[model samples]
Target: MSEFGQVLRGAFGPARVFEQRPLAPLTTFRVGGPADYLLETRSSDEIVDALELAGRHGVPVTLLGGGSNVLVSDAGVRGLVIRPRGGAIFELDEQHVRADAAVTINGLVRWTVLHGLGGLERWAGTPGTVGGATFGNAHFTGQLIGELVTGVHLVTRQGHECDVPVADMHFGYDRSRLQDTGEILLWATFRVERGDSDALRSTARASLAYRKRTQPLDLPSAGCVFRNPEPGRDVVPDGIPWSAGALIDRAGLKGTASGGARVSTVHGNFIVNEGGATAADIRALIDRCRSEVRRQFGVELREEIVCLGDAPVISRS
Candidate 1:
């Protein structure tokens, strides 16, 4: 074993650390290269230890959750990739629930509904972990995940664990303070309301059905590709409104292809992998959408999907 491997084993034990782990399989998009070191952490202590070790070794660290909103580079990520496996959930009261960051958003939504809790049913079909959703302030329709969040438990880059309240999160469209801070979200507490279980379930079913009809769920995609442009912007072409999907569709980029990546015919905002897709291919498709949208509507669309490793190549003209 190499000296670094020996050090990792000593710090995290032999069972927790892996070498040269392929990252593609870890993501919903199923595209990425590999991580030089991958660490599976199930608790806050483990995560802090892994981060500390990475710092001591002068190696960068990347945090991966449910892997639904990210695109990993074809060249892979350097340093350690920490995948948190904690999935604990607790009911704090009749109107509150606490969930670990690693808990799936669907699982949390279902649990809340099963317990007759309201406020998260709109996210019934959402993919990815609570952490990923919270980081991006995931939204459906006009309801955002940040709205239900009361507080979050996070680990900072300096290895300090802290509790952050909702007001400090800076929640906005597809954004949160976590995006810039690189803090690891450990868990979150949400404020819910008691509702009729049957009614909540019905609402969840309706929302999920709408998603199924509108989204290309059968194919592999990292959810929406771009954030909708702000309303009333002059850059929005006349009659374009402010929908990202509508913008892409109007740009005539729907179903456009680059290698195995193609814009979804059902939802212009999604770029689906038609099997054998690479990160580069998806990047190319994203660039095409951005460039075409800018060309046709004079609006610069921003990406909602997060890219890891190498930065995306934006097209000019």
Candidate 2:
């Protein structure tokens, strides 16, 4: 073990510090090499301790949630990868609920419906944990998760634990201040309202059905690859509509393949792995879509997916 490994084991115990852990099984993309150190944390205190230990050892840290909306490099990640576990939800009141960061969005949605809470039903079929959703300000059916967040508990990279109000979150279209600050989300409190159970279930079912029909759910994917171009900031492609999927479809790149990665035929914004896709393959397809969209229509597509480690180079041919 190295100096950092020794310190980590000394502080957090040897059982918590794992070396050269495979990362593919931890992600939805099912691609990537391995993490040099993997720390499984069950609570906010453990997360803070892990971060403090890494800081003392001068070792870097990566926070992974439900493993959605990310593209891990084939070269793998160096340093420690902290995965928060032991999801627990606390009912603050009849109209408020607090949950750990590891709680899945789908699980939260289901829980809300079961309790007749009406705020997160729109994200019924969304994948990933509350931490990932809050990091990216996840949205579905015109509803962003950040809007319902009342408070966020996080540990800063500097090892300080603080509670951030929702207003300070700086939520925006597919973005939040957390993205820039590199803070590790621990838990969150959401404000909800009492609603009819049957009505909420109906809405949830409809949302799930819509995703099943429009999204390529049967295949492995990291969800939407690009954010829709903001209105008034960019010129809308003629006859292409003002959506990312529409623009990519109009560019005639749907189903385009690079190695094992291919543009999802059901949704142009998603790149699916057919069987044995590499990070390079996915990057190539993303580059093609961006280039073609920029060339044909004067709009620069922006990626929404987070790429970790060294980025793969895409070949132009």
- Candidates' lDDT values, in order? 0.88, 0.88
* Local distance difference test, candidate 1: 0.88
- Compose the digit string of candidate 1's lDDT tens values, residues 1-317: 65666788898788988888899999989999888888888876888888888888888899898889999998788888889886888999988899998888989989999998998887889999998999999999888889899999999987999999889999987889999999989899999999999999999999999999999999889999899888664367677768889999998989899888899999999999999989988988888888888887789989899998754444222
Candidate 1 pairs with clashing backbones: none
For model 1, the superposed segments whose C-alpha errors exceed 4 Å read 232-234, 311-317
How many clashes does the backbone of model 1 have?
Answer: 0
Model 2 over residues 36-64: C-alpha lDDT tens digits?
88888878888888898888777899999
Worst 10 residues of 2 by lDDT: 308-317
